[model samples]
Target: SQTIHQWPATLVQPVGSPLSLECTVEGTSNPNLYWYRQAAGRGLQLLFYSVGIGQISSEVPQNLSASRPQDRQFILSSKKLLLSDSGFYLCAWTAENYGYTFGSGTRLTVV
Candidate 1:
């Protein structure tokens, strides 16, 4: 019965702004948390992942960072966002054999 929660549903920001999105899980322990981005006319790409508390692995280095302050709490942050950051922000997690599930996602529009 694990579930993921993401906030704001949608956002609109200008170029060179700061961004922060939060995701949290319930009904699981030591889950693998991931942040992915899906751009228009492009496929999904893994940005960051956390295997446990305070253990995060970055798949790419850009204008983004991730953190896991608690077992089930994951946060995505950026110091100064770029126009390229405009895309769908999805939070996902996978179980041992249950596969991966994603959140509702935050549709970010940067102008």
Candidate 2:
């Protein structure tokens, strides 16, 4: 009975502004969490991932950073946003024999 939750389903951020998105998984233990971004009409791009607490791996060197504060909580942050950062952000967790489960997602638009 595990579920993933992502906050701020949608966001409109200005250029050069700070941004923070949160994701948390419930009813699971030591799950693999990941952050992905998808541009309009494009395939998803992996941003970051964590196999365990305090262990994060960045897929691309962009204007984004991720952290796993608690065992089931993950955070994505940016000091200064860019126009290219606008996309659909997704938080997912790998389940045992259930594949990957995703959150409701957050659509960020940078103007």
Candidate 3:
């Protein structure tokens, strides 16, 4: 019974404000974690991923960063957010046989 938890289902922030989003998994260990962003009607865009604790991979060049501080914990952070960064943020994870499970997602609006 593995589950992923993501916080702050919706957010509205001013331009250039700091951002922090967290995702954690239960009943799983060392799962591949990912951060994705989806625009209004566009497909999902991979932002970052982690294979293990302290190991992170960036899929695109942007103003965002991710870190895996624990085996089942992943965090996304930005020193300053941009208006272009506004979107639906999703946290997902997958194990050996289990398919990707995603969080409810956070809708971020930047003004």
Best by TM-score: 2
Error of 2 at 34 (Å): 0.1
TM-score-sorted candidate list, best first: 2, 3, 1
Cα misplacement distance, residue 38 of candidate 1 (Å): 0.3
Ranking by lDDT: 2, 3, 1
Better of 1 and 2 by TM-score: 2
Per-residue lDDT of candidate 3, residues 26-98 (tens digit): 9988899999999999999999989999999999999999989999999999999999999999999986676
Please say which candidate is ahead in TM-score: 2 or 3. Answer: 2
Clashing pairs in 2: none
Q: Estimate each model's TM-score.
A: 0.95, 0.97, 0.96
lDDT of each: 0.92, 0.96, 0.93
Best by lDDT: 2
Residue 5, candidate 2: alpha-carbon lDDT: 96
Error of 2 at 41 (Å): 0.8
C-alpha RMSD of each candidate structure in angstroms: 1.0, 0.8, 0.9
